[model samples]
Target: MKNIPKVTALCLSIVFISLSSISNAQQRYTDYDPIADFYNRFWSVPLERLAIGKLEKIMLPNLKPKAEILDLMCGTGHIAATLHKKGFRMTGLDGSAKMLEFAKKKIPNMKTILADARYFTTSKKFDAVICMSDGLNHIMKEEGLTKAFTQVYKALKSGGQFVFDMNWEERYIKGWNLRGLRVEYDNSEGIISSSYNKNTRIGSIKFWLYYPIDKAKNTWKRKAWELTQYCYTPQQIKKALQTAGFQTIKAYEANQDLGDARNAGRAYYVCKK
Candidate 1:
């Protein structure tokens, strides 16, 4: 790593130790399998809109109609599908097999990959790479975050840009520190509860999905998953990007540069490699 600023160096060191703690916490948890099946029905439309808006802001200055782009941690390919409609060549990657399955079904011509963002790589480079909707936060540790950053840097062609967002503490205090959040579909209902710990800067969401299997008999399918996210200060994020070799970096309020992202409760970063 190049010589980082003192404050940034300190932040990087903090992330080094935090990774172990985060890993321990992770071992106690299990992945949510059904969330992938539920993703499109619940979150795809709004999240895809915000992501497309942000990408337009970054790409409008000089965009190639068929620019090769990678969507990291792409859940259900909502954003990629939107970009594809605009004539961009899009690839969607996510760790969830079910999510990618749905994405492939939805976009038969689009390419999808099943991989973890922290260690994902490819010989094929891209014009731009995007990790949005608090996808970076899902890494749960600074070191893994840095690795993801490095991987993105290496995967981009010269002058390629990386765009992503992370949740702010303010977002956690207001959004995650809540309970009894409920979503109901015609045959499926889900109860979501969220909590955040200031000391650990860890936010967790527990989702209980109930789906009717038999209408008259009232038989239901119950599935659950626990998700965790870590909060990082702007300094930490900048430092990590810098360490990953991003030369030009810009930070924007979720909606300042992209209207659709206003009050999105996350900070967006655009970095050039």
Candidate 2:
């Protein structure tokens, strides 16, 4: 009886430590639940346009008309909607339920899957798979990146293409270093701040959005969240793609290929399985 208390305490301590470690691991990735509305409303438009333009130039020409396309990390379904209009069958897959809610609302007839990019499987293989707006960067480890590529590979048809963009180190150094970090709207204001750790090759961006709940009472509400991205070298990415059975891989510097000044530190990869 005397020793039972010590054993219970030890088990409790182990459980606590395990839970804490799980939480810490989860914190390494961003949860889009809180910011899904803000992102859908404020941030996705221009980026969607840019991505569409690039896709048209780079990936669309290689596809058959009405090709089956999978939009991986397809937040809000904007790209899927646009491509749907262009005559392709679109299916969106995203990790965030809130983001998928918006996506489903946007395209009532479209199919959206809520699953992690690293492990999602589909009975339907796609003609092309796209992960846009630095989506792959959110996979914070090389193992996760490789797994994501493998899953994408498995989801694609034979000779299918995978197209995605990633942020290079220069993007974090120049863009995320507190540049253009503040914005205001009629009813809300937002501030974004970020940091990049060279040693870990990780970058984190924190967002704070404030909106008025009652103008007469001067009452306001604020929502805050942080997101992290990992920076992988081109060599690392290419190797992972090859390991995932992508034989024909071509990389293009976004600004050079698209002639867009905004894409200075971004690169796009087109891989064929």
Deviation of model 2 at 98, angstroms: 1.0
In candidate 1, how many Å is residue 79 off?
A: 0.5
Whole-model Cα lDDT of every candidate shown, in order:
0.74, 0.80
- The alpha-carbon lDDT assigned to residue 124 of candidate 2 equals 96
Q: What TM-score, over all chains together, does every model reach? A: 0.82, 0.84
lDDT of 2 by residue, 1-273 (tens): 011111111111111111001123333222676677878988789879989999988999999999999999998888989999999999999877889999898789999887878878899999999999998898877888898999999999999999999998878777777733776644667677888888988888777656666656655666666688888998999989988889899988867777877778899899998
For all the candidates, what are their Cα RMSDs to the real structure? 12.0, 10.7
Q: Tens digit of lDDT per residue, candidate 1, span 1-273?
A: 222112211111111122223223223111333466667777888888876776677654566779998999888888888888888898998876778887888789988876777767798999999888887897777887899899999999999888888888877887785666777755567677889999999988777656555646645666566678898888889888989998699887765555534355677788888
Q: What's model 1's overall lDDT?
A: 0.74
Q: What lDDT does model 2 reach?
A: 0.80
Scored against the true structure, residue 226 in model 1 reaches a CA lDDT of 69
